[model samples]
Target: MDKTTEEKFVTLLEENQNIVHKICRLYTNNRDQHNDLFQEITIQLWRAFPKFRGDSKFSTWMYRVGLNTAITLYRKSKRTVQTQDFDAVMFRISSEEYDDTVEQQLKLMYSAVKELNDIDKALVFLYLEDKNYSEISETLGITEVNARVKMNRVKKKLKKILNP
Candidate 1:
């Protein structure tokens, strides 16, 4: 790519890097894994940048690429030995006045989210981001109805995991 394109890409990535970081956090369990995933997603985004057609918001497109890259890597066989807990890095709430019960519940919910399959996890992430069904479907390459159905099922599944 030309320098101009490279600059543009870098600007966009910088502007929206938190999206990539969030995906990394969701898919990875440790700092090393998170960094690795972040790099991989950035590489994937760079490679696919030429084909980006401005059909959706840049952040939305970033979510699609980032989530797909994460799910793809997550589906591969586990080879890395996990040496640290993810709670400290991924779930730390820095607010001094936070409620303990709410914090614990959030941790439990995130733990349950971690246990979900790749697709289900992606759906939950998108849903939590307040993406409409159409956006979710476009991101995951599923029909809108399918996205709605899967989201409902995921909600029920999460409820079971949380309550049971």
Candidate 2:
């Protein structure tokens, strides 16, 4: 990367720190895990930076790198810690209304996500974030038919988990 390219890369990353942070929160659950995941994601993004052609919006492309990194970076072989104590911490956005019941629902969603196979989790995350089938397919380099099938399966699985 030349000086100009390096400057451009820095600018892109500075602009998308929120994207990285949001994905980290969703994927990692808590502080230690969040920091580790953030570091891993930053490394992955830097590694994949060269391959980012200007074919799509930067946010979308960033999401692809992020999802891939979170899905494939490391497998935690041992379970650690326990449930989040409500009084200690929670996920909240000032721009959105925060109801305790909704927080519980969000927790349930995250729990269900944690139980998913990596590819399934990626599909689920993308679906929840309102990605269209074509966009998800493109991001994951899968065919539209495959993306559709996977999304249907994900919805059914989420329904079962949420209902049961």
Candidate closest to the true structure, highest TM-score: 1
Strongest candidate by lDDT: 1
lDDT of candidate 2 over 1-164, digit per residue (tens): 56676567667877777667667656675667666666666666666778888899777898888877776554442323222233322222122212235446577778887777778877777777788988889888899999999888888888888798
What tens-digit string does per-residue lDDT give for candidate 1 at 29-136? 766777777777877788799999999989899999999888777776362422323333222212122123543545677789998898999999889889999999
lDDT of 2 at 101: 54
Q: Cα lDDT for residue 47, model 1?
A: 78
Clash count (model 2, backbone only): 0
Task: Point out where model 1 deviates above 4 Å.
Answer: 79-105
